[model samples]
Target: MMASVNEYYQQMEKTGIPKRFTHVLPPNEIEYKNWLVGQNGLPPVEEWRDRMYAETVKLLKTMQDGCKDQWDDDYWTAVIESKGVESPTNGHSLFSRCS
Candidate 1:
């Protein structure tokens, strides 16, 4: 029989691999998490995938929120000016230089 999720999480933590590091380690850890959360009769591969996706979304949202207030127009203008590069004109956008 498979171990319960709590048991599996405890085992991983005791082994010095936090559950979050499953994103970077071998597939076995992720498989184990999936296996633990699955129904007794069938595996919940979709659920595991959704969980990972949700983690990524959460991380992105956190990063975005952290930077949201730190990057206003004046900030970009100062950054460009400091680098001796001309800022974009009123009619053009920053991305225009990339084209």
Candidate 2:
């Protein structure tokens, strides 16, 4: 018989982190910006903003892959807000607590 989703997640969790966990971007995007700064160039602000936005989305996808439990948005938002990150103004704010 097929295992229930919860059972499957529990088993996977016991086996250490999933392979997708490695797909996350480096925790410090600032390092990338720093490298850019060292390169002697500064183009349109909106372009950098768009790159940040896209990177943020990719990071969120990585988080989703690592989140074995199928938690709804409300649960996650409440968890985030409860942890004093009411707005999660930055990417690290919301995901730094992940196991």
Candidate 3:
């Protein structure tokens, strides 16, 4: 079963990955999120949430796989922060942009 969003958030916190890291999610993830949003109500909403959690977990794992030895908190932190957050020009919530 896929983990809950809270579980994923907790895992990210434990690993020193900030929630802000979502701001820098790769293009595929962004596309997935957009597609998921477009399919709203076609399936149960919980299913959407679960799929998103799975995708995010997959991305994180791929990132960790690229590390030389262990997960490098500093490197990930710098990469995430360097991407920074863009303001929502259309007045949508900042969180919605990540969604």
Candidate 4:
């Protein structure tokens, strides 16, 4: 299902994150921006706003591809907002986290 701007903002707030940036930009637009260029060593367009929303969708789909029930949409949203991809090195994320 296609997500909405409000859904993205809600996801961000659920993680105790400020929704100011994403409140301005939607999720698909935010992801497209990240896929484009960078700004000051950070995501150029709207900063880390709605990143949780986009990443949560990505993570859930990733898990659904193989792991399936290992994570539902809710679980993915939490993890995406929590620690992200959990790389062995940085132990955080591959793409979407601000800090």
The model with the greatest lDDT is 1
Give RMSD (Å) of candidate 3 vs. truth: 15.6
Candidates in order have lDDT scores of 0.56, 0.52, 0.52, 0.53
Off by over 4 Å in 2: 1-45, 65-99
| Superposition error at 15 for model 1 (Å) | 9.4
> What total of clashing residue pairs does each candidate reach?
0, 0, 0, 0
Error of 4 at 7 (Å): 0.4
- Candidate 1 worst ten-residue window by lDDT: 90-99
Across residues 29-89, which tens digit of lDDT does each residue of candidate 2 receive? 4556566766877643334344546555665687755654333445445655665655444
Shift in Å, residue 21, candidate 4:
2.4
Residue-by-residue lDDT tens digits, candidate 4, 14-60: 97768666645553576667666664356555333355556656766
Q: Who wins the TM-score comparison?
A: 1
Number of backbone clashes in candidate 1: 0
Better of 3 and 4 by TM-score: 3
Residue 65 local lDDT, model 2: 57
CA lDDT for candidate 2: 0.52
Q: How good is model 4 by TM-score?
A: 0.22
Cα-based lDDT at residue 2, candidate 3: 48
